[model samples]
Target: MLEVENLDLHYGQSRILYEVSFQAPKGQITTLIGNNGVGKTSTLKAIAGRHPASAGTITVDGTLVRLTTAFQAANAGIAYVPQGREVFPMMTVEENLETGFACLPKTDHHIPDHIYDLFPVLRDMKARRGGDLSGGQQ
Candidate 1:
Protein backbone atom coordinates (compact mmCIF):
# COMPACT_ATOMS: atom_id res chain seq x y z
CA MET A 1 0.00 0.00 0.00
CA LEU A 2 0.96 3.62 -0.53
CA GLU A 3 0.32 5.94 2.35
CA VAL A 4 0.75 9.69 2.70
CA GLU A 5 0.18 11.44 6.01
CA ASN A 6 0.14 15.02 7.14
CA LEU A 7 1.70 16.09 3.85
CA ASP A 8 2.70 19.67 3.26
CA LEU A 9 4.38 21.18 0.21
CA HIS A 10 5.64 24.58 -0.79
CA TYR A 11 7.10 26.53 -3.67
CA GLY A 12 9.66 29.08 -2.49
CA GLN A 13 7.90 30.81 0.43
CA SER A 14 4.37 29.97 -0.71
CA ARG A 15 2.67 26.91 0.74
CA ILE A 16 0.86 24.77 -1.83
CA LEU A 17 -0.43 21.88 0.25
CA TYR A 18 -1.48 21.59 3.86
CA GLU A 19 -1.66 18.41 5.92
CA VAL A 20 -2.76 16.27 2.99
CA SER A 21 -3.35 12.58 3.72
CA PHE A 22 -4.46 9.54 1.74
CA GLN A 23 -3.89 5.86 1.15
CA ALA A 24 -3.78 3.90 -2.08
CA PRO A 25 -4.00 0.20 -1.59
CA LYS A 26 -2.04 -2.22 -3.76
CA GLY A 27 -3.67 -3.52 -6.95
CA GLN A 28 -6.07 -0.61 -7.18
CA ILE A 29 -5.95 2.78 -8.85
CA THR A 30 -6.68 5.99 -7.00
CA THR A 31 -7.53 9.28 -8.64
CA LEU A 32 -7.10 12.78 -7.25
CA ILE A 33 -9.79 15.19 -8.32
CA GLY A 34 -10.09 18.93 -7.82
CA ASN A 35 -10.59 22.10 -9.78
CA ASN A 36 -7.49 23.71 -11.26
CA GLY A 37 -5.00 25.42 -8.90
CA VAL A 38 -6.50 23.72 -5.85
CA GLY A 39 -3.27 21.88 -4.91
CA LYS A 40 -4.25 18.62 -6.62
CA THR A 41 -1.22 18.62 -8.92
CA SER A 42 0.94 19.71 -6.02
CA THR A 43 -0.25 16.73 -4.00
CA LEU A 44 0.62 14.32 -6.80
CA LYS A 45 3.94 16.02 -7.33
CA ALA A 46 4.77 15.51 -3.65
CA ILE A 47 3.80 11.86 -3.80
CA ALA A 48 5.70 11.25 -7.01
CA GLY A 49 8.78 13.03 -5.66
CA ARG A 50 8.81 15.48 -8.52
CA HIS A 51 8.50 18.07 -5.77
CA PRO A 52 9.53 17.45 -2.19
CA ALA A 53 7.01 17.87 0.60
CA SER A 54 8.07 20.37 3.18
CA ALA A 55 6.77 18.07 5.92
CA GLY A 56 5.01 14.78 6.63
CA THR A 57 5.75 11.24 5.44
CA ILE A 58 5.19 8.84 2.58
CA THR A 59 5.35 5.05 2.77
CA VAL A 60 5.23 2.40 0.12
CA ASP A 61 4.52 -1.17 1.25
CA GLY A 62 5.11 0.01 4.80
CA THR A 63 8.64 1.28 4.10
CA LEU A 64 9.37 4.96 4.58
CA VAL A 65 10.56 6.64 1.37
CA ARG A 66 12.96 9.56 1.09
CA LEU A 67 11.39 11.46 -1.71
CA THR A 68 14.19 13.94 -2.09
CA THR A 69 14.64 13.52 -5.84
CA ALA A 70 12.90 12.16 -8.92
CA PHE A 71 15.41 9.30 -9.14
CA GLN A 72 14.72 8.25 -5.58
CA ALA A 73 11.00 8.32 -6.20
CA ALA A 74 11.36 6.26 -9.37
CA ASN A 75 13.46 3.71 -7.47
CA ALA A 76 10.62 3.59 -4.97
CA GLY A 77 8.23 2.72 -7.80
CA ILE A 78 6.64 6.15 -7.89
CA ALA A 79 6.23 7.66 -11.36
CA TYR A 80 4.69 11.05 -11.92
CA VAL A 81 3.69 11.78 -15.48
CA PRO A 82 2.55 15.35 -15.28
CA GLN A 83 -0.56 16.42 -17.07
CA GLY A 84 0.16 17.47 -20.69
CA ARG A 85 2.36 14.36 -20.95
CA GLU A 86 5.84 15.75 -20.60
CA VAL A 87 7.19 13.87 -23.61
CA PHE A 88 9.81 15.75 -25.57
CA PRO A 89 7.93 17.28 -28.44
CA MET A 90 10.94 16.87 -30.72
CA MET A 91 11.73 13.28 -29.83
CA THR A 92 10.53 10.30 -31.80
CA VAL A 93 8.32 7.66 -30.21
CA GLU A 94 11.24 5.28 -29.81
CA GLU A 95 13.38 7.97 -28.21
CA ASN A 96 10.56 8.89 -25.87
CA LEU A 97 10.27 5.29 -24.72
CA GLU A 98 14.02 5.25 -24.18
CA THR A 99 13.72 8.12 -21.74
CA GLY A 100 12.04 5.79 -19.25
CA PHE A 101 15.43 4.09 -18.95
CA ALA A 102 16.58 6.89 -16.66
CA CYS A 103 15.06 5.08 -13.69
CA LEU A 104 16.28 1.64 -14.71
CA PRO A 105 19.61 -0.11 -14.57
CA LYS A 106 21.71 -0.34 -17.74
CA THR A 107 20.84 -4.01 -17.98
CA ASP A 108 17.13 -3.09 -17.98
CA HIS A 109 17.33 -0.27 -20.50
CA HIS A 110 16.03 -1.98 -23.60
CA ILE A 111 12.41 -1.64 -24.66
CA PRO A 112 10.43 -4.76 -23.91
CA ASP A 113 8.46 -6.42 -26.67
CA HIS A 114 5.48 -6.45 -24.34
CA ILE A 115 5.39 -2.66 -24.43
CA TYR A 116 4.92 -2.67 -28.21
CA ASP A 117 2.42 -5.49 -27.81
CA LEU A 118 0.44 -3.42 -25.35
CA PHE A 119 0.60 -0.29 -27.48
CA PRO A 120 0.73 -1.41 -31.06
CA VAL A 121 0.35 2.09 -32.37
CA LEU A 122 3.62 3.05 -30.67
CA ARG A 123 5.37 0.31 -32.58
CA ASP A 124 3.88 1.48 -35.85
CA MET A 125 4.78 5.08 -35.14
CA LYS A 126 8.19 4.52 -33.61
CA ALA A 127 9.69 7.07 -35.98
CA ARG A 128 7.01 9.68 -35.41
CA ARG A 129 7.73 12.76 -33.36
CA GLY A 130 5.93 12.84 -30.02
CA GLY A 131 4.30 16.15 -30.91
CA ASP A 132 2.81 14.61 -34.03
CA LEU A 133 0.76 12.11 -32.09
CA SER A 134 -2.61 12.70 -30.48
CA GLY A 135 -2.63 13.48 -26.76
CA GLY A 136 -3.82 9.98 -25.87
CA GLN A 137 -1.14 8.44 -28.09
CA GLN A 138 1.53 10.51 -26.44
Candidate 2:
Protein backbone atom coordinates (compact mmCIF):
# COMPACT_ATOMS: atom_id res chain seq x y z
CA MET A 1 0.00 0.00 0.00
CA LEU A 2 0.99 3.61 -0.51
CA GLU A 3 0.41 5.83 2.48
CA VAL A 4 0.67 9.61 2.48
CA GLU A 5 0.02 11.37 5.74
CA ASN A 6 -0.14 15.00 6.72
CA LEU A 7 1.49 15.90 3.40
CA ASP A 8 2.48 19.49 2.84
CA LEU A 9 4.05 21.29 -0.11
CA HIS A 10 4.96 24.77 -1.21
CA TYR A 11 5.97 26.61 -4.34
CA GLY A 12 8.43 29.19 -3.05
CA GLN A 13 6.36 30.74 -0.24
CA SER A 14 2.86 29.82 -1.32
CA ARG A 15 1.56 26.58 0.14
CA ILE A 16 -0.08 24.32 -2.40
CA LEU A 17 -1.06 21.42 -0.18
CA TYR A 18 -2.10 21.41 3.43
CA GLU A 19 -2.11 18.18 5.41
CA VAL A 20 -3.28 16.11 2.45
CA SER A 21 -3.52 12.46 3.38
CA PHE A 22 -4.66 9.29 1.66
CA GLN A 23 -3.93 5.61 1.18
CA ALA A 24 -4.09 3.56 -1.98
CA PRO A 25 -4.43 -0.07 -1.12
CA LYS A 26 -2.69 -2.75 -3.11
CA GLY A 27 -4.34 -3.96 -6.32
CA GLN A 28 -6.59 -0.99 -6.79
CA ILE A 29 -6.57 2.25 -8.74
CA THR A 30 -6.96 5.55 -6.93
CA THR A 31 -8.05 8.65 -8.74
CA LEU A 32 -7.65 12.23 -7.59
CA ILE A 33 -10.49 14.44 -8.64
CA GLY A 34 -10.48 18.20 -8.36
CA ASN A 35 -10.82 21.33 -10.44
CA ASN A 36 -7.69 22.90 -11.86
CA GLY A 37 -5.15 24.33 -9.39
CA VAL A 38 -6.66 22.40 -6.52
CA GLY A 39 -3.31 20.75 -5.74
CA LYS A 40 -4.18 17.44 -7.32
CA THR A 41 -1.09 17.43 -9.50
CA SER A 42 0.98 18.75 -6.61
CA THR A 43 -0.13 15.91 -4.42
CA LEU A 44 0.78 13.35 -7.07
CA LYS A 45 4.09 15.05 -7.72
CA ALA A 46 4.99 14.85 -4.05
CA ILE A 47 4.14 11.18 -3.84
CA ALA A 48 5.95 10.47 -7.07
CA GLY A 49 8.99 12.35 -5.74
CA ARG A 50 9.01 14.72 -8.71
CA HIS A 51 8.71 17.59 -6.20
CA PRO A 52 9.81 17.86 -2.62
CA ALA A 53 7.25 18.08 0.11
CA SER A 54 7.85 20.59 2.81
CA ALA A 55 6.51 18.15 5.38
CA GLY A 56 4.78 14.77 5.66
CA THR A 57 5.52 11.09 5.52
CA ILE A 58 5.33 8.64 2.63
CA THR A 59 5.44 4.91 3.06
CA VAL A 60 5.28 2.19 0.46
CA ASP A 61 4.50 -1.24 1.74
CA GLY A 62 5.20 -0.15 5.33
CA THR A 63 8.67 1.19 4.52
CA LEU A 64 9.29 4.91 4.87
CA VAL A 65 10.49 6.57 1.68
CA ARG A 66 12.84 9.50 1.31
CA LEU A 67 11.42 11.77 -1.37
CA THR A 68 14.51 13.87 -1.96
CA THR A 69 14.91 12.77 -5.59
CA ALA A 70 13.19 10.94 -8.43
CA PHE A 71 15.76 8.18 -8.28
CA GLN A 72 14.88 7.31 -4.73
CA ALA A 73 11.20 7.31 -5.58
CA ALA A 74 11.60 5.17 -8.70
CA ASN A 75 13.83 2.72 -6.86
CA ALA A 76 11.08 2.48 -4.32
CA GLY A 77 8.56 1.73 -7.09
CA ILE A 78 7.11 5.18 -7.38
CA ALA A 79 6.68 6.71 -10.83
CA TYR A 80 4.90 9.70 -12.22
CA VAL A 81 3.18 9.42 -15.61
CA PRO A 82 1.99 12.88 -16.45
CA GLN A 83 -1.41 13.54 -17.98
CA GLY A 84 0.21 14.53 -21.26
CA ARG A 85 2.14 11.22 -21.48
CA GLU A 86 5.68 12.49 -21.79
CA VAL A 87 7.21 9.74 -23.85
CA PHE A 88 10.31 10.59 -25.84
CA PRO A 89 8.82 11.18 -29.27
CA MET A 90 11.85 10.05 -31.24
CA MET A 91 12.87 7.11 -29.12
CA THR A 92 11.90 3.60 -30.13
CA VAL A 93 9.45 1.78 -27.86
CA GLU A 94 12.12 -0.48 -26.42
CA GLU A 95 14.49 2.41 -25.93
CA ASN A 96 11.78 4.42 -24.22
CA LEU A 97 11.05 1.52 -21.90
CA GLU A 98 14.68 1.46 -20.88
CA THR A 99 14.41 5.02 -19.61
CA GLY A 100 12.62 3.84 -16.52
CA PHE A 101 15.79 2.05 -15.54
CA ALA A 102 17.42 5.41 -14.89
CA CYS A 103 16.87 4.96 -11.16
CA LEU A 104 17.74 1.29 -10.97
CA PRO A 105 21.18 -0.20 -10.67
CA LYS A 106 22.58 -1.54 -13.96
CA THR A 107 22.25 -5.10 -12.70
CA ASP A 108 18.52 -4.64 -12.16
CA HIS A 109 17.89 -2.55 -15.25
CA HIS A 110 15.79 -4.81 -17.41
CA ILE A 111 12.08 -4.95 -18.02
CA PRO A 112 10.38 -7.97 -16.48
CA ASP A 113 8.53 -10.66 -18.37
CA HIS A 114 5.21 -9.76 -16.78
CA ILE A 115 5.40 -6.36 -18.44
CA TYR A 116 5.34 -7.99 -21.87
CA ASP A 117 3.04 -10.68 -20.60
CA LEU A 118 0.53 -8.10 -19.51
CA PHE A 119 0.98 -5.64 -22.36
CA PRO A 120 1.65 -8.18 -25.07
CA VAL A 121 0.84 -5.63 -27.74
CA LEU A 122 3.97 -3.68 -26.86
CA ARG A 123 6.10 -6.67 -27.79
CA ASP A 124 5.23 -6.15 -31.41
CA MET A 125 6.07 -2.44 -31.43
CA LYS A 126 9.58 -2.61 -30.04
CA ALA A 127 10.95 -0.78 -33.04
CA ARG A 128 8.25 1.85 -33.29
CA ARG A 129 8.98 5.42 -32.28
CA GLY A 130 7.24 6.48 -29.08
CA GLY A 131 5.43 9.32 -30.83
CA ASP A 132 3.87 7.00 -33.33
CA LEU A 133 1.78 5.21 -30.75
CA SER A 134 -1.79 6.29 -30.11
CA GLY A 135 -2.66 7.98 -26.83
CA GLY A 136 -3.84 4.75 -25.24
CA GLN A 137 -0.96 2.80 -26.71
CA GLN A 138 1.50 5.28 -25.42
Give the clash count for each candidate: 0, 0
All candidates: CA RMSD in angstroms? 1.6, 2.4
Off by over 4 Å in 2: 26-31
In terms of lDDT, the best-performing candidate is: 1
lDDT of the candidates, in the order given: 0.90, 0.89
| Shift in Å, residue 122, candidate 2 | 2.7
Q: Write the per-residue lDDT of candidate 1 for residues 50-123, one digit (tens) a residue.
A: 78899999999999987777778889988877876888889999998998888889999899999999999999
- Location of the lowest summed lDDT over 10 successive residues in candidate 2: 66-75
Candidate 2 structure lDDT: 0.89
TM-score of model 1 vs. true structure:
0.89
